[model samples]
Target: MAIEAQAPPPSATGPAVWLRKHFFATWYDTVFSLVFAVLIYLALKAFIGWAFVDAIWRVENKDLCTHDAGACWAVIESRGRLILFGLYPYEEQWRSTLACLAVIITIALSCLPSFWSIRRLPILWIAGFATFVLLMRGGFAGLELVTSEQWGGLSLTIFIFSAVFVIGMPLAVLFALARRSSLPVIAKSFGFFIDIVRSLPLLALLFAAAVVVPLLVPDWLQGNKLMRVVIAFAIFFAAYQAEIIRAGLQSISQGQEEAVAALGMPYWSLVIDILLPQAFRNTLPSTINQAVITFKETSIVTIIGFFEVMASGNAAIGSGEWGNQYVEVYVFLALIYFVFVFGLSRYGAWLETRMRLGHA
Candidate 1:
């Protein structure tokens, strides 16, 4: 008697199959996963209890916090303005709000494919930055003058990051090209300069820009302290970004450059159309990482006495009235950072996807 061969089992799919494959592949895997799952559940439960179940929310009242075992979010409720706007006058904070919104809108628009052109991007950024400054400074159109010194908190942080990127990117491109110059002198000089800037600590650069530059420059030459710090930050950003762009440029095949050269395009056309675009495409991730870094580094301005968001957060909790609520204040600050940084990272990921699909 001949027996018929049995068919192989049907291929698995769905949630149960996925779970068993990944989390319960073996007895050890199942045990470890169960432990971690329980740990995560406990952590979430504790966070929910502290953040919502026992938290206080009423504004301008600290009395409720003295007896509370949960997070004293009342501190945030009371001092949210100080954290958001810092030393900016309470009455004029409406301007700061609009200014912050301007920068955010500009950034959002810049991320879109429609505004990615060199001409369009430059125009959009100019308008956006002008609006931010006009609203924050407010010297014209019957608005009261608020000097740069008075600019602080989130608006200042946004301005610093935007200005640094706007200024530094072009500067970085120029440095990258100069470092790759046909002449050894030009290449070596830019390379040396880039290395020197990269070698120095950012804090030291800011200190020299803030404290030492004043003694060296004439009174007429010493512009706003904020502007000086921004310039220094931009230079430091340029050095690193220059190297990133250079690496991108170097990654291109020599055959592509030769082909482009044979096409008899002007040098600028070759760079603007043929080379830089591909370079940026190659280094998109690194460029995005650099931008995120520059944004967070704005907090370093506080060390030089500029009250960006981190400094503002400190001010929120330093007033003794809400001193015990430091955790809540820091958490709140972290959430603000998380919003911007996460959004940036998501945007970067989107761009990468677009580029891969050739939609960029």
Candidate 2:
């Protein structure tokens, strides 16, 4: 006698299946999930009510804000300019705004894959930086020249970030190569140099450059406070980045280099054409990580009297009128930081994907 064939198990689909699998897979899971769902809903509702429903938005109505329960967003509306531009001259603030946009556009253009080549990248960066400096400094085209001391707010932050990255990246590559030198003396010396710099706190380094170096160096050598700080920051960034790059170099198989050498390629060609490319591709993520850290560290310059974004925020709240709105200013500052950092991370991920696909 033939037995009836068994049917395959039925498939679950859509929201009901998802709920059963995740929330009701076990009794404890079901209970916890329901409890969490209620808590999340209540929290979200409360936040929405405070942040939007009861929030005041008019600058003129800022006095209406009480110490009761609602968020005082009107403070932000009234004082947003001061938060963004700080002690930047009100009439010249438009120049700062345009300069900031120029820097942002430059950063965006640099991140695109199309400008990745050596010829294009240098030209793009130089032109971009020139425009940024020209617009901000304003010595050309009949515009008044603004000194570094006069620079403040988001413009200062952007300037520091760009200058540090541009200078630090090449220095990092050089340091990494030197650290990996075949000669023991050179490698050891480079390693010690990197270690010494890396061991020092960024604040100490910035302090030394901003204050100590001036007393020791010649008159002309002692540049603007901003330049000194940027140089110090670049040194600090390079030290950390060099180690990351050397680690990437170490990750590559010796056989690949050996094979290239056996093919009669010159040492410089082997390094430039094969080794450096592979090492950089391998270390792109780490490089981006270092960059993000450096970008955040720019806020430290405010301690040395440079009015970066953090300083601007402080100025925004320090004013007696909006003294209680420090939290709002900080939240806005955080959003700006998030935008830059998030964009950098996304670009890094894109570069990694491209490298993996052999596009780099």
Q: Against the true structure, whose lDDT is highest?
A: 1
Query: By TM-score, how accurate is candidate 2?
Result: 0.93
Report clash pairs, candidate 1: none
Query: Per-residue lDDT for 1-360 in model 1, tens only?
Result: 999999999898999999999999999999999999999999999999999988888865456676557788888878899999999989999999999999999988988899889799999999999999899999888888998888888889888999999999999999999999999999999999999999999999999999999999999999989889999999999999999999999999999889888988788998998789889999999999999999889999998899899999998899868788899999999999999999999999988988988933
Writing each residue's lDDT as its tens digit, candidate 2 over 1-360 gives 999999888886899989899898999998999999999999999878877888777878788777664677877787677667766777888988998888888888988879888799789889887887788788778888888777888888988999899889889989999999999999999999999999999999999999899899999988888888999999899999999889888998999889987999998887778878888998998899998988899999988888888997887788788887666677788998999898889989988988899853
Screening candidate 2 with a backbone cut-off below 3 angstroms (N, C-alpha, C), the clashing residue pairs are: none
**lDDT accuracy of residue 29 in candidate 2:** 95
Error of 2 at 100 (Å): 1.1
lDDT for model 2, please.
0.86
